[model samples]
Target: MKLKMHISKIKCINDLTIELPIERGLYAITGQNGSGKSTIVASASRVFFNLPMKEYFGDTVDGAMIEFELDGNKRSWHKKGKSWLQKQTGSMNIRGFYEGSLIYGYRFKDTTYEKLKKSESIDKAKLRPSHEFIRKNLGLILQGDEDYYEKLYEVPREYAKFDSSIFFYEKNGIQVSQFHMSTGENLLLSILNSLYIKNKERKNASKQCIIFLDEIELALHPSSLKRLVAFLEDMARQYDYAIYFSTHSIELISGIKPDNIFYIERYNDGTIGVNNPCYPAYATKFLYDHSGYDNVLLVEDDLAKSIVTRILRKEKLLNSRLVHVLPCGGFRNIIKLADDVTRNNLLGKRASICIIVDKDVKEQAIKYKKENGLASSCGMNFLPIESLEKYLRMSLVYNVDQKLFKRLSDYVFQQRSLQELIAEYRKLKEFDTDKNGKVLYSLLDTELRNRRTDRAELIDLIVEYLFEENKQPIQDIKKFLHKELE
Candidate 1:
């Protein structure tokens, strides 16, 4: 089952809709602070568990409503003068879904430890085994405790024993409970324990489970946050769980797939918008990140960056003091970063942003601009050729001087002519046709490495020769660089 939520007139978010697969995977909700991340989670919690709306959104719930879709069926809860009217329910396994928990503000403390110590609820003999997942992963979050073992401690109530008394022990039997544990340790243990207890109660392990964790990365080190994310990803896959976490951590976003990320933005019009499958760079709060460069050029990949760098170096603009060329991984990502930086003036008065993509994507860029109303003045432009790889290959096969060709023959072809190597390379059944020519680039790198030659230097040399042959586009880009620099 998948879930789609449409929220209207809720707190800072005037209107927003987010759809995500709920069967099994990790999903991230990311944005700048105060972009109504908590409100989205609260709304889902209210819909799924019947939690109160006033708990998240206070007295100003005048015309607020949330419409939800499970699979293709729709149901809505509309606010009517402090009361809510529920519509027809969807064909959902409410009991199966409700078995999962919504954990918000996951900050654990020693208060539980104090209660355990004061009360006579400790059940020493009725010990359950510590979760292997938690035991193996806890060390990754806590420093200098890689060899530590987790001890499951239970506190007995009148009817049953609660899994609240968690403890840890070192190799020498040095034990530490939640009272003595660090905040990160306490948080990790509490979360794992809660999940373990809940999941154990499930009658069917294959049933879809949904877990919502809001502000999931609070009060943890970046390294610990990364480890926790890895754990969640594994659990989500292994248990057929859909884990949705609302976070502002770039660390969290770095590990998540772009398609799984949803970026929430508060527009100037006082309404909220969602950018699903958002590029990680676009979701990053670069407005306040303070990149030291005065000007930045966003490109599709490292090859694009290399091409831009070669041109800038030739124009005397390659100095890191004046410009920084960064590869944003893909065409869409570079486009998103360009849009985000331009609209927000993210670098402010101290810096400027330019986007340069390969000419192969010129058509896509044109289509994107026509569809999205992206201004031409946003500084988006294309490289002179389809791509640097194709250009370099053309130069290598046809345009290089005999002296350079002889060097290539000696190093890349084992002293054979380029023709012979080309014939052999083309005969391979699975010739890579990747637009960026990644496989060709790797082959070139390996060949140069075998001959004890620097691949980058050879590429730079090829780019230099190509510049002499292609001056018009080079000059045009130089002018673009000059304008951005100023």
Candidate 2:
């Protein structure tokens, strides 16, 4: 059985729709954060599977309408709420409408009984339905339900007459104990469980099953992610099961078969839309350019791309044909993009990635890079949001000492510039009650005796200080650079 979903009339959306191909491959949902990608999935689940929207999403201004295709027939479902569910003052309504002669009288209310009857016939007569039958044969693994906490040590088998589990990696630590027996053992165990279930169902059944994984990159190491994707693809072929997932990771999409990939975008009005890049017109153009690129450069956001591009051009590294600087939009995209590129041979062995994220993401970014064997690139760089001033100073080759750095950081936090900061310091110095302002002035005066370096190097030092601290070997040099250059 295959399921295709289309959404409309949801909150913040005027007319957003998506079509999920029910083929034996993976489908990824991707977009920027707060773009309503998750809303689309949640809406679909609520309508088609009769799942509660409140459990996953709060009440919003509007309800959703979903259209689905099962077997060769089409059906539609509608959902509406009086107020956002979180307000705890509204009621939600979900109703189904069926189309086509085969299911003319069928409706959502009758589906349970209909499924029971169908299953009874199959079980009693020991007869097999056609492999393409719609309702009774599919399986699902939601984002956070992969591992059964109660079992603790057992993996669940697919099509085992048990409810499907949705696993959310960000909320639940990766269970690695059953696999690597290490820190992320819980995570590894979850992955193994998913694979084990898929294999078990394949061995027992003649019909194909569909698996939907939302945010598939969560809690997965790069190597583990790579392996999981490959295994899913192989399972699609060997077991005839179809896989669909959503991610913001650009790396996860790179180099995959165009026929298997789908792109999603949401509008400000809250509507969602889908794009199939493999369609003849779209595929042809991207295919040509896809071969022309080698390495991918990921940025934190679109603005970062613009800023970094200017800096790279200034540094004369922007002209290289071997490197391509593309805006991935966020850290998740960076990780996904890296995973996809490394797994695909189409990108080639020489392909490398550079990720430039903010200092706030330094911890997660460094962990991802190190786990993925990407720490050696010098390509993964973190720049503090507050260090833009440091960049401005370095652009003039002005040495920024530790005292200056601290002062600048404080100034930036206060939304002031260096000159403004100096002026304010002077004004406070006149009062001189505690002499804190004068002390700051004296510190800055003494620290400004060193030679200045490039802005990029200065930004790197600030990031290292905030994130890597004593763990990084350059801490001493970074301090020396700041003290001597200022």
**What would the per-residue lDDT of candidate 2 be over residues 175-207, giving only the tens digit for each residue?**
322223332333333344445555665676654
In model 1, pairs of residues that clash are: none
lDDT of 1 by residue, 34-73 (tens): 9888788767755456555564567657678988887667
361 in model 2: Cα distance from truth in Å?
42
TM-score of each: 0.62, 0.39
Positional deviation of residue 411's Cα in model 1 after best superposition, in angstroms = 25
Q: Could you report the Cα RMSD, in angstroms, for every candidate shown?
A: 9.6, 22.7
Query: Model 2 off-target regions past 4 Å?
Result: 1-3, 11-14, 46-48, 60-63, 80-152, 155-188, 204-207, 268-271, 278-486
lDDT of 1: 0.65
Lowest-sum lDDT 10-residue window in model 1:
95-104
Report the error of model 2 at residue 231, Å: 1.8
Instruction: Report the number of the highest-TM-score candidate.
Output: 1
